[model samples]
Target: MEEQLFEATRAGSKRNDAGPSRGGGEMQSTTGATSLKLLLDTNAFIALEPTSTAVERGLEFGAELARLAAEGGHRLYLHEATRRDFARDHDLARRSAHLALAAKYPALSGIPKSALADLLTRLDLPAPPLSESNDAVDLEMLAAVGAAAVDYLVTDDARLRGRARRTGLAENVLPLAEAVQLLRDLSPRPLKPPPAVEHVLSYQLDPHDPIFDSLRDDYPGFDAWFAGVRRAHRPAWIIRHDDGRYAGVMLVKEETDTPYGLPGRLLKVSTLKVTDEAHGRRYGELLLKTLFNHAEHHSHDAIYVTVFERHATLVDLLTAFGFRDHGRSPVGELVLAKGRRPSVQDAALDPLKFHTTFGPPAIDTRAPFFVVPVEPRWHDVLFPDYPGQLSLLTGEHPYGNALRKAYLCNAPTRRVAPGSTLLFYRSRERSAVTVAGVVEDVHVSHLPEEVARYVGRRTVYTLEDITRLCRSARPVLTLLFRQDRLLEPAWSRGELKTAGVLNGHPQSITEVCNEEGRHWLQERLNEQR
Candidate 1:
């Protein structure tokens, strides 16, 4: 069991993203790292605690954590904010942890609550603002890493993942499971091509550090920014650098803040430039990927960039890393957004449109109309974990009335032909970037609400928009007609995951199996097929 854990801790984070994540999309990683500074979020703590089932499985989650920290390959850290967040959100578990810790170390337990809180605070755990935003715990976790000068933080929390990326702290972010995997990569990846600067770097150096003078002119506002960062008293990483060339550098929020409320760990890459002299190697992607692993470890919400439309290709490249596309314009550039609401809804009840299917059976090929996949421009999106989500969605979400109207009736049956629009919301990990799938074949009676939007309308979806849209507006989701395009430069995980509904169904319906994940629907279709 320990062996399995040790190996997991040593594996690369790139491999952990093999499964489907957000917006019915897949994270196909091409880069990763082995040993990284590591931290854990509340969810990670829960999963690793001996009392948790994750430990009972002989996985030995906690012991492995200790081992990683002790071995130096994994720098396991915990922030006060992280612990506090855990205590607040998962009160019972945290209380249990406190009690257990007290029992394990009687002397520590005897410490007063206030003293303990102070001590824990002194221990340097991250605890951000829980009032204006719920990211206090998340930010605290990142701060712990920045304070401890650790390189990674691991957790499954969506918001944390997004936050890590935004603060230029991507290198210190990671997921619990993903961190375990990274522990295995100690051998390191062979040096790749020199990174072509993917984005520009814009930030002033900290004047407190001697090198600040050399870089101050280029970075601009070095003294003020660093002072402000220090004044915040939050855990901001001031890695005084290995070369002694830099005394201390603050790497947090120098770029973007918790995305104007789009949720999850969202970051705007304000500084992504590599030194011009290092231009020969394409290490930017590889390095960023490593940084991203660190960011994921730390639990930020999402990483974003306000790039002009002119850099479409560069944007497309980042899209693959789960760095979702946020539709906002870069300043100094003329940003244009064209929107005309074709369907209007009453302002009060605000009826969001959707569809429903009677039941299912029969149907063979998804070639004509089965599960037409989707293509969200931004691949990486995270969301908060909600209840009743473990069960594969059959129809409308039963937890809320707003969502319930879209649920599918799992029983009664029939042979659905290709082109059946089943609009069911597919949940993304960190962000609820709802993915609506269009049924191309009739296998099981898939949910129809999401289909109404995917196959029903001829509109273009910022695929991740529904997640943001659902929070404020529930549009009148309705579907009409559009010629089926089984194959057209298929790009999207929804097209593949939507098919999972039919293929993953337990009921014996049609011999038509559409289990081809993202590729299931339009995977093999011709451009005109």
Candidate 2:
């Protein structure tokens, strides 16, 4: 009876009647159905592109996905926005390629223009003068997903990911790496349930604010209680995001606060949030993954929560993801339990790993090609030893000789002059003709995550900005995007470790040209020719 009392009274303290944080523990999903409807972000689409050196991994990724769909019953969601983006970008590429041909005849240039116009209209490009809303682009994506009622928005983009978390846009925004691994957790592999980043917000906030004030009633002394819980469990961790200073955090605990004599293994979750001014991102889900780890580490018998009985939306999630209602408290508050019923308890938990790890993902990001002035910030950092950022350097890569292109795009990350260096990473497929590059460049298409970081946000160029910088910035070494592939087809299984790009044992080499970065980029110029 005493235990039941512990579970009973706190039903009201739950997040929106989230049964007061279940006391005792949280359970691993050793037997849960796939209650999530996953929607891939732009990065995922790029990963699926055919030209990526990581193309071989795509086959395995798909196979893993199919396995998950068969067993867990998860519905993969794709937004019209994503499809539209692809269409528009594809149209741009086709038009640009055709225009290049038209340029040879001069007279046909007008024809390509006409074709381009038709392509643009066919893509239904959202007319510019876009919404002034901070996350207008993100909102477009969200509305696209919302219409389909997806359970999660999986992405790695810092800005867009945050927007989803702030507005409660989707069920969760997960990293591409984790998203693939989740698929691997199904049959054929031991179900190793690792800590998951579902609905994680990678920053923190003051609980005293107005929004929190309204939520304070749930935990009369939430701040105090949280401090104590952290001191008790000590599972605090830091998260990293792109172009941001603050790392996201999570405040979760295995609490003793049970509700209404229910099965008491409830893990209390709090402040699964990102700090204010967080570029709306996927931090919410990033933080939740941390708690998932804590619950598993503590070996809690079950997880329970107190939340509003009417949060139909949240309720749908909780129910789908593996939480069950242990019957509401006598006061009419809802009580939820994990590992209670015979339903979804994460079958993956029974195994040692719940997610699969691949070599760093590859991306063929596209942006309008152009010459841009490399900022002093980039030069000073990358080439302090160089006499002049104007010096030209080049290399021949055998890896780029076969299967794809025949030249090395760029060499090691080094400093270059302001107007001297031109950098850009383009998608090989369609959309995003290319992502303009500046000082530092991230070759996600060929490099791993860690190495990519060393190159992350190093560039501060947009298609328009590139033009301004080109006029005066000194010419630095050119970093182009070329193709590299495996000599043998079998090497293509699973994830290609990110390091392979940095150190691969290939057999040939090619010296490439930087014509694409030449003066005056005609939009839609192709890199191949």
Let me know the TM-score candidate 1 reaches against the reference structure: 0.26
Model 1 misplacement above 4 A: 1-37, 53-69, 72-74, 86-94, 98-128, 131-134, 146-148, 187-529
Q: Which portions of model 2 show Cα errors greater than 4 Å?
A: 1-211, 217-249, 255-266, 270-280, 309-320, 329-333, 340-529
Model 2 — TM-score against the truth?
0.26
Error of 1 at 217 (Å): 52
For 257-330, candidate 2 gives per-residue lDDT tens digits of: 65545454656544333443232222333343334435645655556665665444335434533566777755
RMSD of 1: 24.0
Quote the lDDT for 216 in model 1. 58
Q: Residue by residue across 378-459, what tens digits does model 1's lDDT show?
A: 2111101123332112212111111111111222334443344432222233212232223322212122113212221111
Query: lDDT for every model?
Result: 0.33, 0.33
- Quote each prediction's TM-score: 0.26, 0.26
